[model samples]
Target chain A: MENLAIQLENVSKSFKYFQLKNVDLTLPTGQIMGFVGANGAGKSTTIRILMGLMQADSGVVKVLGHSQPENQTLVKKEVGFSSEEMKLYGAKNLAWHIDFIKSIYPQWNQAYANELLKRFDLNLEQKIKQFSKGQQIKAQLLLVLARKPKLLVLDEPTTGLDPVARHEVMAELALILRDEDRTVLFSSHNTADVEKISDQITFIDRGRILDSNDKESFFENWKKIQVELPSETLLFRHHRSIGIEQAGKLASVTTNAFTPEILTDMQKQNIKVLAVEKMSLEEIFIANVSYRRQGE
Target chain B: MNLRLNPSMIYKLTTKDFLLFRPFLVVYILICALAAGVMIAPIEGAYYLGVILVITVSIGSGIHFALTSVIIEKKENQMSFIMGLPINATDYAVSKTVGGMVVYFLNWLPMLVITLSLIYFSHLPNGLIPISILCFLQILTGVVVVLCIGVGTGSEGFTIVMVVIFNILFNLFLSVVGQLPGISEFIQGNEAVFNATFFSVFGIEILALILVLSLTLFIKSRNACFL
Candidate 1:
């Protein structure tokens, strides 16, 4: 069996005001793991530690079967990282940067770089400082993408892009996944993008991972059940229900473990089920975070 | 902990700095040329002032290199790009320290050689040679201190404060070195000479440079986490 592309066991880090606690994550090869989190939700910190840019204060972190901040140099050779905090050289033009990165990485693909330059509508002669934010991001992505690394760890890669640029970047990333051996792990606050492309979805908030599961199961299990309560009697809350909001005699309950037994439980309580709708990734993420934050 | 520093990686990293600061290098060369012209012309009052200018330019070039490559890189969030390469903290810290020192030495070396030539060929007292060498070592000490500040601290404000402190210490050192007994006596004498005091002060400066560079590396390794 092939080893996991990324793994973290009980990883934790502490800043002055925030603490990332017991962050456990694992992603096997050939899967894109979308690390979904709000701003300052430890996504960037996790990604940085995973990339070996920073060391975790506690716990083990292994990327591509090598330990972090120790085997970082070896791990880095095969792992391509593109982060918002990292910028292209401003004084150098895109072509110069391409050449610079090409010189450092032996696996650089000139043909693919040229294709990305055309697809991203980036001018090779333009200085990086002069490019629009979207253009700069695309240029940075091109540098990493051309290396043809075994794993790609992108942190907030689509944060500042326009809709069209985001779409193009996402499309390119999806195309990269066509290779059966390559794995991707990208962190994003934009749930739509994560939901669209990720095979595994991990939600993090307040420096804690609230939920991590396969995308299909995450969608399938989180059902927003709408019910009409009889009279003023409160219905029996199912064990799996994470959140319940009541308005007059109507109730909307969010559950992580949607099952036939949940409907049966409601039926025994004389609560008439009106409709059960699938929760969007955004909704599931929000409910999960809010529930966890309330000390659940 | 398993990572070992690669000399080739350090060279490549240093080359990147040299290429990026080529303009500054050119400016340094021109300033040295101007200093050389003044020395050759043997202008009466300009001779001593020209020496000061050349030394100042050499030291200033080092400070600028450190500020631009280290402090500014941190301020502008460019360290991420460097650390993203296939190098760990030791590689990064050592490369920057060695790179900055190499450039500083390269800039200071030519000036040192030119000044020595002037002392050897011209009518200037060779006694000034020993004293002048001690002063040049102080200049190297200053550059190393500035490099330490840049690499050891990520705070831009702290770096600025330290640089200001560097300038003040540099001026204080110049006056102190000028007032030392052997150096003072040498300035008033006619022949090249060396005394125990000259060696002591030179030795102290050399030792301080080594200590500060070590401390900088230690600090760098302690706070190696790239944001």
Candidate 2:
């Protein structure tokens, strides 16, 4: 528990229109976990709970070894929270904001803030409203990063960036998070964005986490195998496979629990194995979501 | 949980909001000073003109302050930025309420003093003081009502609507208070009278202000989720 930066067990919340069922999550320190979810998939809601902006209806929530909502003030001091819904006072410049924030957080590192000011290429004196959307996100990141927080909770940090800006933001995050002492919970709907920098990934949909694993485990365990269709097409099926796509003499079977044994098992059934293809993160997410919803 | 305010953070947040409203405050104070000057001047018809100017600007300042400083946080999507800081729901609510009340006093206090001073220093009837007190209290209460609604709902539209309603009610309050037996009989006397009618109305106004403000804070504290 001490080694964990965040822990949520059977945490649940209900609203008039939606409900987050019993949710259990854990994130060890020094890991960048991409919280991937589609729109309104409870990414932001869960993050808000972790940040102590909302109280859980039941169960436990602890961040950095402290209880939630109860210790939110203490937790908030150590956590840097940024979201698309967050905006700085547009009437004030970044410099003014920096100073205001600095006054509140005793641990605010002025030297790092100065360095980030240069690295992010933000004009300190310009009002935040005058900044382009990309610059605005960069400014938000810079403020969060310079705080030198124990954990960074970013909810959809790249939702509205253009391709180039997205690349730049991702590149900067990848570079900065190379330090193993800091932790991050980066949430987004874009699989490519999560795939780029997350050491670990947690996929959520409709208020439930579908899957959570390391990047490699996700890559290694899910696969799309190309095969030649047998005369008895209906006879080609595997217990480990979640879905299949067939076209004439060709067939592709997607398996979540992939193994060399599955390929061997397929060949014994008279289906000619062509090749085993690795699935992209996006493909795996879609297939998994589709399979889970259909099965439920 | 209790309010659990960190004094330093609350102070910073309160000051931050106050600074944001300071420029508007400067301009509004100027208008207030001009109106006060006119009220005290010996120029013909200046007192009546000054009375109208001061009353309008007094209410105007409260509405402006509530619009810009209180409701604008939620209206402009900046509440998340504030909530992201090292504070809790209670801290945000208290700081906003404190800052909002400051706006209320900035305009109302000066006008209160000016009106009371005019009756005391000049040859005007001192008995007008009770009515003057009621009028100032009405303005102060109006601002509180607006501030409470703004803080509670963070709705600019509803708060503005209430502002209009409060102004209309302010005029009606004057008519009703003028017709009260105790106030009407002694309105022109040489001595100022503080009657039961004055006490009754004053008590309710004060009670409403305190209750409304308390209710705002209570709701915010009890509702843990700010976002």
Among the numbered candidates, top DockQ falls to 2
* Model 2: residue A254 alpha-carbon error in angstroms: 1.1
Minimal lDDT window, size 10, model 1 chain B: B218-227
User: lDDT tens digits, residues A36-85, model 1?
Assistant: 99999999999889888778999999999998867788898899998887
- The top-ranked prediction according to lDDT is 2
Q: What tens digits encode model 1's per-residue C-alpha lDDT throughout B23-139?
A: 777778678768755654656877777777777777678778888888887767777887778887767777778677787777777777777777767767677778778777887
Off by over 4 Å in 2: B38-46, B110-130, B178-204
Give the lowest summed-lDDT range of ten residues in model 2 chain A: A229-238
Q: List the residue pairs that clash in candidate 1.
A: none
Candidate 2 interface RMSD after superposing interface residues: 1.2
What tens-digit string does per-residue lDDT give for candidate 2 at A1-296? 35999999998889987788788888999888999888988988899999998888898999999998788889999999999888888888998888888887778888888877887789999999999888889899888888889999999988888999988888877777774467889999999989988889998888888889999999999999988967735544579998988887788899999989998888888789999999999999999899888877
Best by TM-score: 2
Against the true structure, candidate 2 reaches a TM-score of: 0.92
